[model samples]
Target chain A: DQQVKQNSPSLSVQEGRISILNCDYTNSMFDYFLWYKKYPAEGPTFLISISSIKDKNEDGRFTVFLNKSAKHLSLHIVPSQPGDSAVYFCAASPSTLYNTDKLIFGTGTRLQVFP
Target chain B: DVKVTQSSRYLVKRTGEKVFLECVQDMDHENMFWYRQDPGLGLRLIYFSYDVKMKEKGDIPEGYSVSREKKERFSLILESASTNQTSMYLCASVRPDATGNYGYTFGSGTRLTVV
Candidate 1:
């Protein structure tokens, strides 16, 4: 069973515009969500995250919004740049502060920022 | 900065050959994970260990085994290679107690091909 799902396999947005990537999860036990950006042939890098208790978390140009009632989350990147073209993965964990750090990742969404 | 290193960046093996993929973490993390990435399947966990010699199977564990003799290193063993197993393998590590401050760090990944 796929607990986490990224419905869109790819997304395209113009540079300097807002890019929104969506993810949904089926597991209610998951309370912590994270976003990772990965370039070709490189390891994934952490971008931003939001806890279930909070509706949104922002870090510089990246923002993550969580809706517990919908079991969905979205990552919003403002002023998207060409450098943002990469595969973005959404991961969820049951609990992070108490040692349960096993992440369940989504299928990933390939974002292409056009000039 | 935390660093996770994989033994090989690429490997090719025959159908029946045995294969081993090694991973080492430099941050003294207590949690390590092995995952396989395919074209559309995303990242599927094979195994994870929270402590030395203690392992738990993830979503997909068939044809694979793991050994964690030391806290810093984890190895994934393929009992018998198969063409179906050809994919990109990723190793990740994180502190078990890590929360918002610490997230999982992944290696560059190893692309394995079975002929």
Candidate 2:
């Protein structure tokens, strides 16, 4: 079963506009969430993260919002730039007894920012 | 900065052949992971190692195995190559933190093809 799901396969937005990508999860054991941005032929880099304790976390132009009750989270980029176009993946880590800290990932959403 | 390096950017192997994908992390992080990325399947964990000489199967470890003889290196091995196994393989390393991010420090990825 897919514990994490990104319903939108892709998103297109104009430069200098807000781009929002949504993700949902079916596992309640997940306590932490993260977003990663990946470009073609490149590894994914960490964008931002939110703990279950907080509803939101912001890092400059990138912000992540979490809603624990709904098992949903979103990444918002303000004034999206052409350079920001890439595949965005949302991952969740659940607290486990083995301390593995394994992450469950979503299918991903490709964000295209046009100038 | 942590550097996770995959030995090959791309590889092609014949069916019934054995394949190995290597991943090395410079930071000596205890946690290492192997994930396969598909068009609509996102990233699925194949295996992960928490320390030297230790490994565990993840969600999709059916046709794959892994090795972690050293803390800095983790390798994914395909016992028998099949067309179904052709996909992008990614390796990641993570330093355990209180914030819980298992998706940190990923390598560029290895695109493997089986014919």
Candidate 3:
């Protein structure tokens, strides 16, 4: 069974608009969540992350919100730019002490920021 | 900065051929991982090594094997290549943290096509 899920396969947004990508996970044991952005022919690069102890985390134009009660999380990119167009993947993992930092990832959502 | 290097950017192999994908890291991290990214399936782990001569299976281990004879290198071996095994292979090195700062640096994936 898939522990993490991204229901949306693709999303298109005009430049400078707010782009929100959502993810859901089934395992309540997951305490750490991460977002990674991947371009074609390249490996993924870390974007942002949130811990279960907090409901939200932000970095400049990117913010991640976690709803622990709903087993859901969302990544919001404010003023999304063309350069932000890529496949975004949400990943979840339990404490490293338990799983040795093995990350379980969602299928991924392709975000397209067009002018 | 830590960097992970994949030996090949692309490879095409015929069915029933033995394949090897190499990964090397330029950091001191002792943990290395191999993952395959497929369309609509995100990234799935195949194998991981915590230290030299120590390895662990990940979510998908069938038809794939790994070797970690040195600290800076990890090798993924396909005993006999199959078309089903064709996918973009990525290698990563992990840095564990307690406060949700788990850093995973990935290489520029190698795309393998088996006919």
The numbered model that scores best in lDDT is 3
Q: After superposition, how far is residue A2 of candidate 3 from its true place, in Å?
A: 0.9
Error of 3 at A45 (Å): 0.1
Candidate 3: TM-score of chain A is 0.96
lDDT of 1 by residue, B1-115 (tens): 8899999998999999999999999999888999998866788999999999999999999999999999999999999999999999999998866435346899999999999
Query: Interface Cα RMSD per model, in Å?
Result: 2.1, 3.3, 2.6
| DockQ (Cα-based) for each candidate | 0.63, 0.53, 0.57
Stretches of model 2 off by over 4 angstroms after superposition: A96-99, B99-102
TM-score of 1: 0.97
Q: Candidate 3's residue-wise lDDT over B78-111, tens digit each?
A: 9999999999999999755444465589999999
When summed lDDT is taken over every stretch of 10 residues in candidate 3 chain B, the lowest stretch is B94-103
Candidate 1 docking DockQ? 0.63
lDDT of 3 at A2: 87
